[model samples]
Target chain A: MPDVCKAPAAADALLEEERFQALSSGEAKIVEAAASRIFPTTDTPGAAEAGVVHYIDRTLKEIYPKQIASYREGCAALERNAKETFGRQFTELAPDQQDKILSAFEKGTASGLADASEFFALLRKHTMEGMFCEPMYGGNRGLVGWRLVGFPGQQFGYEDPYINRVVDLEPIAHEMPFSQQEALDGRKS
Target chain B: MAARADVVLVGIGAVGGILASELTAAGLKVVGLERGESPPYSDYALKDAVHAIVRHALHDSARHEPIARRDKEGENTRRRPVSSPTNQVGGALNRWTGQSNRFAPGDFKVFTQEIASGLAERAGASLEGYNVADWPIGYDDLEPYYTKYEYEMGITGADGENPFAGPRSKRFPMPPLRDTAKFVLFRDACRNLGYHPYRTPNGILSQRYKPPMPYAQGIPERPGCVYCGHCNNYGCHVHAKASTLYTHVPAALDSGNLDLRTRCKVFRINTSPDGKVTGVSYFDPAGTVQEQRASVVILGGYLYENVRLLLLSRSEASVHASGLGNTHGLVGQHIMAHEDVRVSGIFDDQIINGFIGPGSVGGRIDDFNSNNFDHTKLGFIRGATIGTSGSGTPIERYNIVPRGMPRWGADYKKYLTRYYTRSFDLNMQPETLPHKDNYVDLHPTECDAWGIPLPRVTFSLHENEQRMHRFLAGEGEKIMQATGAAKVWSAFSKRGSRWAGGTRMGTDPSNSVVNDKCQVHGIDNLFVMGASVFPTMAGYPPTATVAALTYRAADFIRSQNALFH
Candidate 1:
C-alpha cells in the first residue's frame, strides 16, 4: 500500500524515544553500551547512533525469541567482568574497560561464561545486521551504515552494471525489488 | 484415505515437475506429492539481505529436516550442514543461482575415456575404491533433450561462445544477461591470460522471452531480468528466473489430467511381491496417512530422499529385503557434490560495484572443467569451473575483509568503508569424483519431527577433490592477481552445494541401482529420477542436466504405451 510512498514513521521514531520490544530499559542500556564499544563512534554514526540496540531488541522478539535468555546471560557475563575488573555493571563501565571485556569474549578467554565465543559471535552478528540492515528493520537509522560502506542502498534492479554513482533512492525495506534509481539510495537524511 | 492414479510422482520438484507435466499431457492421470506447500513465488522475491541471504528464509530449516552429516564412517555427526534443497513444490529450482550449464561430453564417459584410456593413470591418480562408472547413455543421446530443456526453460547465452560445449541444436533462446564490472574484470583477465572465457549461461531471462514449447507458451510470460542483485539466495520478484515453479509446475497444473498434492510427505513406495511398485503411502497435510495406488511410480525426490525412500520402504519379509534396489548394494553409493573453494581480491584504485548486478552477470571459463585440458602428471582427474561471481551484499564483506582486521572497533569500521565496495571473489566448484567413502545412508538413530529416520550424508572431500581444490584455489589467486588487485587472500570453504547422486545409473544391474532408462533394477514399473542417477557429476551446476535427463526419462516412460493407454 504505502510501501512506495516512502513512509517516514520509522525515520521520525529515530529522533524520538523508541520503545523496545524485547529488552528492558536496563537491558537496553547494557546492549547499547556493548554495541557502541563493538562498533564505536568514528567519522560516521556508530552502532549506538545507528540504534543497533533497538535492532537487537526487536530481532530478539521477532526472529530469535529463543535466544532472549542467552542474550540476558551475555549481559550478565558483561556485568560480571565489569564488576570483577572495574567495579561496575557493563553500562556503567568506561569504554576502554568494556572493550577489554568484549575483546576477551570474542577471543573466548573470558571467565564466568559457558560459551563466550558463541555469545560474542551472536552479539557481533546481530550488531552487524543492525548496523547494516535497511532502516525498515529498525537499524541503520539515518542510513548511516549504507553511507559508511558506500553501499548506495537496496535497488530492485540496476539498468547499468556499473552504477556506483551516489544516486538517492528508496531502499526496498519490504519484499521484492522496488526499482533502482540509477544506483542504490545513499540518502543521508 | 485412499486415492488412485495411473502414475504417482513423488517429490514435485525438478524431476516430478517434468514428469507431472509430461505424463498428464500424454493423457495419463497423474498425482504429484510434495512435502512442502507451494507459496506464491513473487511473495518471496523480497530483497532483504538479513532475511533472504544471511538467514536463508527461503531454504529448508536444518533443525527439523537436517541430513545427518559425518565426515567418514566412524566419526560422530559433525555440525557441517549442506544447504538442503527446499522441500517446496519447485524444489531447489526455486532458488538456484540460475547458472544453467551443461556437462562436457567427456564428463559422460569418465570410465572409458578417463580410466580405461589411461588418463587417470597418466595423471598418477589412483582409481582404487572409486565408484566411477561410464554413464550408459552419453552426451549425443541427451543433446536433443538438453536443447529442448534449454529452449523450454528460457536459457540466455551465446551458444557458440563456449568452445568446449557439446554440439548444439540451436542458439540459446535469449541473449545473455548484461556484463557488469566483475564480468568485465574477470573477462579481461581471462583474455589477457589467453584462456577462452564465455558469458555464463543462465536460466534467468535476459530479454522478454516466449519459450519455444507449446506447453510453455501457455504459462505466464517472463520479463527480462532487471539486473537485480537479489538473484542469489532470493527468488525473482518478476518471473524472470526459469524455475519449474514458474515453468513446468504451472504447466503441470495447467494440464487437466494432473493432481498436484502439496504438503504430502511420501513415506514408502508400496510394492507387490512381483517387485513392481503398486503405489505409495504418505502423510497428508493433516498428518493422516493416505494410500495412492497406481500402475507406475516415480521416486523423484532430492538425492538424499530418493535414496532414503528405498531404504525406508523395506519391511520384514517384504519385496525389499535389504532396500528396494540394494540387492546390488549400490542404492546409496557414489554420492557426488562440489568441493567448492574461493579467492577474494581487493582493488584500491577502482570500485568493483559488485553489489550492483545479479550473481549471473559474470564471466566463466571452461578451460579447466572436465577433461578439456591435459591432466598428465596432475594429482586429480576431475577439474573445477572457475569464475568471478556473487552479489556483493554487506554480508559478503566478511570474506573480503583484510585478514587481520578485527570484526569490531574503529579499524573494522574503516576497513568496511574502504574495502567493502572495492572487492571481488573468484569462486570454484571442483568436480567431485564418485568415491566409496563420500556416500549417504539412512541415519542409524536420527529422526525428523514426523518420526521418519533422517537420511545421513557420510561425505568428506575425497583426497583427489581436495588436491584439485588446492590447485584451483592457487589458480583463482592467480586470476585475481591478473585483475590487478591491490591485495589478495584465499577465502576457502570446503562446503559444497547441490548434493547429487546416490542411486546411480549404469548398464549392469549387479553394480548400479538403476538403468539408463532410470527404472530401478529388477523392477519394471518403478522409476527413480534426477541427479541421483548421475554416475559422475561435472564441475558445473547440475540443474540443466537434471532437466535434460528428466526430459529424456519422461519420453522413455511415455513410450510405455501399455501403462498410459
Candidate 2:
C-alpha cells in the first residue's frame, strides 16, 4: 500500500549521475571526449556540459541496443587511435590539441588516426544528435538548445496567432505525455 | 496441438478486420492472429511526435526486417525475408496515411492496351520485354467492395467530384475534410493551371461515427479529426482516424464467434505433402512455438512477408522446387516502387498557411495519372498523380527557391522569411513500370534474430518511369509558375524508392504469385493480400487500392467458405 513517490530513499543518485554511473568506465570516457568536439563550446553550453555523456549512457541502456553496441565499439576504436596517434587519452588532452587531432583525423591525413577516422566521425555524429535531440532524453535539459532554435514543446495545436509567421516562440518543459507511474499504480490524478 | 476453428485469419489489419466480422456474422468460429502488440487507441493518441514519428514506434525497424533482393533470374534461388506489419491487432492499418484514392479504370488493364498501343506506335510494342500485365480482375469486380470499405470505415469524400475518376454507384459516405488556407491555394493553383482540383478521399472521419452494434462495447468513442498535423506515416493518436481498430476490428472482436491473439509471429505455413495448406507454425510473444490448424491459412502480412512465407514454406520437391506457387519462377519478380518527385513554388503575394493542415488533406490533379491523358507523343507508358499534400510541420517547411533568386545567405533568407508562410509544393507519385530486372529475394550477408535474411531490394526505375516523372515535374512547375508563383523550381525523382511491388497477382501464375482471388496458385488454402498482389504500381498512393483489394479478398474468402475448406 506504500506510494512509489513517498517511499524511503532506495538510493541518493541524481538522474544524470545515476545514468553516467551506469556506463562502463571506457564508454563514459569516450562519450565525454566525443561530446566536447561534437558540440564544441558554442555561445551556448556544449555537449559535455549539456550531459551528452549521460544521454549516451541512457540511450545505450534504454533505446536502440543494436546501434548502441556499434556506437560503443566505434568510440573504443577512436580512443585507441587517439592514444596511438597523439600519445594521450581523449579526455585528458587540451581542447585545442583535441581539435587538431580530430580535424587531422577527419581529413584522413593523420599518421595513426587515418584508419579510425570513421570511428571519430561516428562518435561526433552520435554526440551531436544526443545534445540537440528532443529534451525527453537527458540532454537539452530545460530546453536550452531548443530555446536557442525557437522550438516550443509539443503544444497539441499551434494555438498562437503568430504560428504561421516566422517568429520565435518561448521554450517549454518536456511533458512526459504518458506516465509509467500511472500504469504501475493504476491511479490517475 | 491443433486448435479447431471455423475461420483462421492472419494479419488483422484493414483487410482481415473486415473479413473477420463478415465471417463471424455468417455464424463461423473465427480466430485471428497478429504479430504486433495490442495497444489501445488512447495509447496511440498519446504518441509524441519525436518518439513515435522520428523514432518509428509502430514500425520497429530494429526488430522487423524487410525482404531480400536479387536479380530477376536469381529470384528462384534466393530466400525472401519477412517484413513488418504490426504483430498486434490492426496490423499496418494502425499507421496508414489515410489517403484513399481509387485506381483509375485504365490502371487495371493499361499494360495490355494503352501501354501496348503506345509501344506499338513507337516500334516497341511487346509485353514480353517488360513485366507489366493486366490485373486478374477489373474495376467493376471490386466496386461494391470499395463502397463497403468506404462506408464501413466512414471514408470522407465527394462522388462525381473527381472529373478523372471512374463512375461510382453512390456518393462517398461522408463530406470532405476541412480545408486549410494551404489547401485552398493549391486548389486555386491547380484550377488556374487547367487542372481539376478536388478534395481527396481519406479514411479520417470528417464527422463522428456511431456504430450500431450493441456488442461493440469497450470500444472508445472518438470525435472527428482535430487536424493535429501528425497524419503522415504515424498512427492517429485520436480515434478519429478510421483505421481498422475503430472500424472492422472492433466489430469482429465484438462478435462472440471470434478469438484474437496478438504478438504471434507466423514463421511458415503448415502444408500437406500434396500442396494443401493445413495450418501455420508461429512463435508466440514469449517465444513459445504454437500451431493454428484451420481449414485454410490466410497470409495478409503486407506484400513482403506474404511472398516470403510462400517461398519459405516450399515443400514437395517436384511441385514447388522453384518455391511455392512459383512454378513459373516469378514469385518475387516484377518488384515496383513509387517514383515520387517534389516541386516547390514560392509566391511573393500569397499568404498560404503551410503548417496547419492534415498530411493528405489537399487537392489532387489526376489529369496525368494513369491513362487519363494520351501518351502517344510522350515516350512514357505511364504517368504521375500531381497533388499538393503538405504535412505542414513547421520544422519541415522551408521556403521554395524562386526562378531567379540567389542561392544563399541574405538572398535565401529574404525568400525564406517572406515565403515561409506563402509557399506550397506540387508533389507527384509517378507510376513505376514493373520490370523483370527488379525483384526482391534474401540478402546473402545479413540475417535477423529470427535467422531470416532481410528483404534486399534490388531495384531501379526503368527509363519510362524516369522520363515520365521528369515530364510530370516539368508540367507541375509550369502549373505553379503560371498560377502566380513568383518563382518555381524543378524537382527530380529518385530511382527505385517507392517500395510497393513484391507479390503480383495475375491470370497466369507464370508471371504472378497469386490468382484473381489473391490465393496462391499452387497452394489452394494460402491467401496473399495487400499491395503485393498489385500487378502494376498505380500513379496514386497505394493505400486505397490496398484497402479495396483487402475487402474484395475478404469477401471472396467468405463466399467460397474458405474457412471451412
Candidate 3:
C-alpha cells in the first residue's frame, strides 16, 4: 500500500479520474477555482492546498449524488458570470478578479444561470467540511487544517492530571481513525 | 401469518430498550420492532466528521422518509429533507449527548403553580389556548426509578450538587467526571455572579463501573469516558457513553426472551372490535408485510412517530375513529420542544480548550432552571438551566466566529484559528409549555417509502416561550460578561423544534392518551412510552426521565400480568 501521508504526487495521480467522477474536466477546474477562492492559500494552506476539490469530487460521487445537478448548474452560472464580468473563465482570472466574482456570488448579485446564491452556499459549506474534517475523507491533507486551527484530532482521553489545566499544546493528528468497533470488540471478548 | 409474543414493543430506543430488559426479566417474551438496522459495536468505532456530521449517519435519513413541517396549521407543510429522529435499534440514544437530568419538582406541577400564583393571568397568557396540565405523578413518584436508572446505567455525577434539583433518594451511581479548564472558569464565573455552579449530570461514565444485580451479567463492563470530544452527535466507540444499545438492550437479549426484529417498520397497530389492541402490522427489511401478535402492545417510538402511528391507524371503520386513545381528540395535541438559547464569548487572554470533554461534561448553574428563580416578577413562567458545555468538535467550532466576521474567506479562517480554542458557549435549555395548537398530524399529500402518510409537525414558539428565551439570552449575556470576556455575543435567538408531547400521559382519559402508568386509557394492554408521555418539556434533557418512566411502566405491566390473558 502506498503511504498516503508521504506520497502526495502518487496519490494525486491515482485519484485524478475519480476526482472528476460527477463533473466534467472543465467543471472540475471551475470547482477547484471556486474552492480556492472560498478558502484561498494565503500564508498557510487553505482549501486548495488541503485537497478540498478532491473531497468535494468524491463526496458528490459517493455520498451526495443528489447535489450533482446543483453543482453543474451552479458552475455553469458561475462561468457565465465570470465571462460576463471579466471576459475570462473563472479558472483563468487573477486572484483579485476571482475574489470579486466570488463576492458577487456570496451577495447573490451575480446573475446568469441557475440559483447563484444557493450554489455559492453549497460550495462554501463543502469547502469548510473538506478543510476541517478528518484526513481520511481525502481533504485536510497531512492534517494541515487541524494544525492551522490548533485542534488535536481523536485524542481518546484526558485524565484528571490534565483536565483542569490549560496548556497551549501543538496539534497532533492521529494516523489511524479512532475505531469504535475495535474498542468495543476488544471489550466484548 | 403473524409471529406471537407476550408483548410487542415498537421502536427499541431509550424507553423501549428499558422496557425490553425489565419485561424480559419479569419472564415476558418481548418482540421489539426497529425500523433501522442494529448497528454493531464496530460501527461505533469510527467518528468520521463526514459521516457523523455531514451525512448524519446515525440518524434516519430524511431523503428516505422525510418529516413534513409547517409553522402554521393552515399553511401547506413541506418535506424537511433533514432532521428526523434516529431509527436504529438503540434509537436516538445511540447518538445522544447524554445530558441526563431529573425533572425538578416544579416541572411536574407547573400548571398548578401557575394557577395558584396567578402568574399566567398576570402575564396575560391564559391557560385557555395552552393545554398545559400538571402531571398526575410527581417527582417523588419517579424518584426511586430515577435512582434505579442512574445506578443501572452507571451515570456519573455529583448528586444533589444542584441545590435547585428535586429531592433524590440516592446519590448518583458514580461521582462526577473530572472538570476541564473551561468548566472551572465557567464555574468560577457563576460563583462570582452569585450563582450556584455544579457538575452537569450525564449518562456517560466517569469511571469503569460494573452494573449491579440482574443487569450486570449480560452487559459488558463499560470503561470510563476517555473525553474523546465526540460524545454528542456521535456514538461511543469505547462503550463509555451509556447508550441503551450498550446497557438495557444487551440485558434484554441476554435473557433469551427478546426477539429483536431490525429493519421492521410498524405501519399500523391492529385492534379488535372491543377496543383492544391485537398486535401490529409492519413491513420487514425485504419489504415483506408481517404481523406480530401480542397480549400487550407498547409504542415506544419517538414523540413524532407515536402521534403519526395513532393518527394513521384512525379510520372511519375502526373502533378508534378519532385515533387510538383519541376519545377527546387529544392524541396529538399539546406538543412541546425546548428552545435552546446560546450565548458565546471569545476570550483573547487565555486558551480555554473548548474541545476537551464529553457532551454533558461541564459546569452548570441550575439557579435559573425551573421555578428556582423569581419568575413571579419575570414575564415567563419557567426558566432555563444555564450551562457551559465542551462538546464542540473541530467542524462545529470552525463555524463559531466573532461578530461582524465574514462567514468565509481569509478573515473567517483567521477568526477560527484564533477563537476555536478560546471561545466558550453558555447555553440555556429552557422549558417550553405545551399548547393546544402545536402538534403532530398525518400529512395529507406526502407519504414515506412504505406509502404511509408522513408525520407533519405544526409547531411555533408561543409568546410565553419567546419571553422566556429573551430573558434566558439576557441572563446568558450577563454570565458571559461576568466571565470578563473580551467579546460576548448571543448566537441563538430563534426557537428550533426539539419535539416532545403527543400521546401525553395524565389522570383523565378525556384529554390524555395514556394514564399515569403509561397505559392507554380504556385500552389496558396498550401503552406508550418516552418523552411522548411527557405533558410538558422540562428544562432538563428527557432521556433519563424517559428511562425511569419505562421502568415504572414495566413494573406496572408485570403487576397487571393477569390482565394479559
Top model by DockQ, which number?
A: 3
| Residue A119 alpha-carbon offset, candidate 1, angstroms | 0.9
Q: How much is the lDDT of residue A151 in candidate 2? A: 40
Better model by TM-score: candidate 1 vs candidate 2: 1
Looking at model 2 chain A, report the run of 10 residues with the lowest lDDT sum.
A2-11
Q: DockQ for the candidate 3 complex?
A: 0.37
* Candidate 2 lDDT for residue A85: 68
Please, what are the lDDT tens digits per residue for candidate 2 over residues A1-189?
112112121112323345453467667766676566655534444555556666667655655555665665655655666787678887777776676666665666665443556655656545645544555566655454344333454545444323235435454444652234124112111
Q: Give the TM-score of candidate 2.
A: 0.80
Inter-residue clash pairs, candidate 3: A179-B45, A180-B44, A180-B45, A180-B46, A181-B42, A181-B45
- lDDT of residue B562 for candidate 3: 71
Per-residue lDDT over B1-565 for candidate 1, one digit per residue giving the tens place of the 0 to 100 score: 4567889999888788878777888888898888876856444566667656665532443344677887889988853333456777777777778888888898899889888888888898866678788999999999988888888878888868889888888888888888777788888899999898899889888888776655355456789888767777777788788777878777777878888889888999988776768899998989989999998999988898899999888866766888898886788899988867878888877777787766767879988888988889888887878887757577656435657767788888777778787878887878888889888888888787689988888888767886777778888888889989898877667565877889999889998999998999888888899889999888988888888888898898888877644
Candidate 2 ranges with C-alpha deviation above 4 Å = A1-133, A140-152, A158-174, A177-189, B40-43, B57-61, B64-66, B69-86, B119-129, B211-221, B345-355, B392-424, B442-446, B453-456, B479-498, B561-565
Summarize candidate 2's per-residue lDDT along B1-565 as a digit string, tens digits: 8577765777787667767777777677887887765766544554344444434532433245544445444443333322235445676667666778888787899767775566535633233446678898888887887777676676788777788887788688789888765567777777776778888888888878754343233244556777666666557766677777766776677777878888777777777767677788888778889988888777776666666777777775546665677777777677787757888877667665555446777778898887777666577766777877556433344323556764222344344445656677877888877877777665667765577656566776666776687788888888777667777787665534435667788877667778888888867777887778888878877767777787777667777753474
Model 3: per-residue Cα lDDT over B414-482, one tens digit each: 778777778788877888888878888888888887898988888888778878888888888999888
DockQ class, candidate 3: acceptable
Q: Which stretches of candidate 1 lie over 4 Å from their true place?
A: A1-16, A163-172, A175-189, B1-3, B57-63, B78-83, B213-216
Model 1 Cα lDDT, one tens digit per residue, A1-189: 122222234432553477777877777888888888888776567787677887888778766678898888888888888899888888877788899999889888889997998999998888888888867667777667776676766677776666334334544444333233101221111
Indicate the TM-score of model 1: 0.93
* Candidate 2 A-chain TM-score: 0.67
